[model samples]
Target: MDQRTDRPLSPYRHFSRADWARLREDTPMTLTQEEVTRLRSQHDRLDMAEVEDIYLPLSRLLSMYVAATQRLYRAQQKFLGTGDAKMPYIIGVAGSVAVGKSTTARVLQALLARWPNVPRVDLVTTDGFLFPNAVLERENLMERKGFPESYDISALLRFLSDVKAGRRPVTAPIYSHLVYDVMPNHRVEVDRPDILIVEGLNVLQAGRPPRDGSAVPFVSDFFDFSVYIDADEPVLREWYVDRFLRLRGTAFSDPKSYFHRYAKLSDKEAIDTATSIWERINLVNLTDNILPTRQRAGLILKKGANHLVSDVALRRL
Candidate 1:
């Protein structure tokens, strides 16, 4: 058993990258460098070594969890004398903005789908659950776009409910980064998949309880497993600023982009603007809402500089 006291008083079993890599012994490396290159987010650095050292082991562990859950579900159904309807196993990925959670989700989706038992794995981002820009502007929540209150929490809960109920052809709203808003009349359909990954900054958060004393389901309540991607605040801020500058040259440069104005800014001016946004919005959200929920995750991926995961903390059973 690998154990450490680095997180003193914590309930998680810590593992360094070397120890974690050993857990994936004999697991084949199925992803190619080209595939990893395409899966990484813009300006994010993810290479084959990182995948082998960190994510390959993660995928193998998730595979075992999924299989065990499937068996348990079958046992429950047999005991209930119910038919063989399978519920999708949901995995929640939560973290601060620009912490590479999206990349992790995408990479896992690609890897898990290739597994023999998990032929269909879909990823749904909570970004889609965010209230439309028009609604946010009307409610004076534009400044708190990524905050928990800015999302359609009830709708998100209902969607998860339907998914857990094995509903087919479930549709979720589509959010566009280029437009910086949810696209009205646009939606993504999720058929019954074997596994579903829900990725967002608030996916691990516990929702506010209703006043009626009745039980209200939280977004995390639907997750079978949850992951939190973490890094030092200074490192995350630097990464955010670097990504912002890189995007200014690509996405922001497009005339139709919502942030087109940023494309014309000089390097120094862009850095200043990015820093301001981080300090004002992203940092506040991370400290007040996101970071507090890190301990709630079943597994935590702690990253070092250059976006490499240096350590992992698995929640003790």
Candidate 2:
């Protein structure tokens, strides 16, 4: 009988948080304590130290990558003798629902925008691409809201395609978490930026390709770099539940809030409700879709129970 281990080789060069922090090496910290605090979400545990140790090194590396990519883009344009508009470098941030993907995107956006001579760094979340609540209700897909099929994938792909084709003033639909819907007739504009950060639960997910070998553009196809935020399932559940609980006293309490009904839930009742929703909706989505795409990321931030990044895995080129 063959006794060899079945585990496959990892394509990433993993580093402990301390070692990764050392890689920051001369990368000037541009974000202030106030800025860091402002960028964080209600349940996010990230701080100035986390920014310096985890994000600064990442910011430095991304700066290098963006610069190199732009240089090559210019060279390619020159070779082809095409006078196209400036091309933007796109970055994708993907993870489980409560794993702090927005926090990562905002931190990176702020840091990269502060880079010398890099003018604009815009960030957009995939929530906007989700089908409207009415549409989901009509289609009886409310339970599958975060799944790939629930998204207007064609519109999303077209938006990315236009941006990559050097189209200007591209508009993306806006979403309202407060009302739990894609706000009607609301949109945000994205001009050609030096960098664009696209954050979502499953932006890196590439479903099975067609047997015909026809071109199937994935959201990740336009990404110059991609990041996946990872944590243990129990830790993620805790965070999600905690965030839901916190919302009870805040957003959920507002009369116009979509989750207003949840505000009056007793502590025990709220806990049960949150856990059930998590297990039923978010957890299923994470396991069925998001986690499978982790290996496709260019970098993975592994978080410990306390929500601090315990290690970094940088994919080897």
User: What TM-score goes with each of the models?
Assistant: 0.97, 0.95
**Candidate 1 C-alpha lDDT tens digits along 189-286:** 88988999999999888766787856555899899999999999999999999999999889999998999999989999999999999999999999
RMSD in Å for model 1: 1.3
- TM-score computed on alpha carbons, candidate 1: 0.97
Residue 298 accuracy (lDDT) in model 1: 97
Q: For model 1, which pairs clash? A: none
| Cα-lDDT of candidate 2 | 0.91
Candidate 2 on 249-314: residue-level lDDT in tens?
999999999899999999899999999999999999999999999999999999998889998889
Q: Candidate 1 regions off by >4 Å?
A: 1-7, 213-215
lDDT of 2 at 56: 96
Worst 10 residues of 2 by lDDT: 1-10
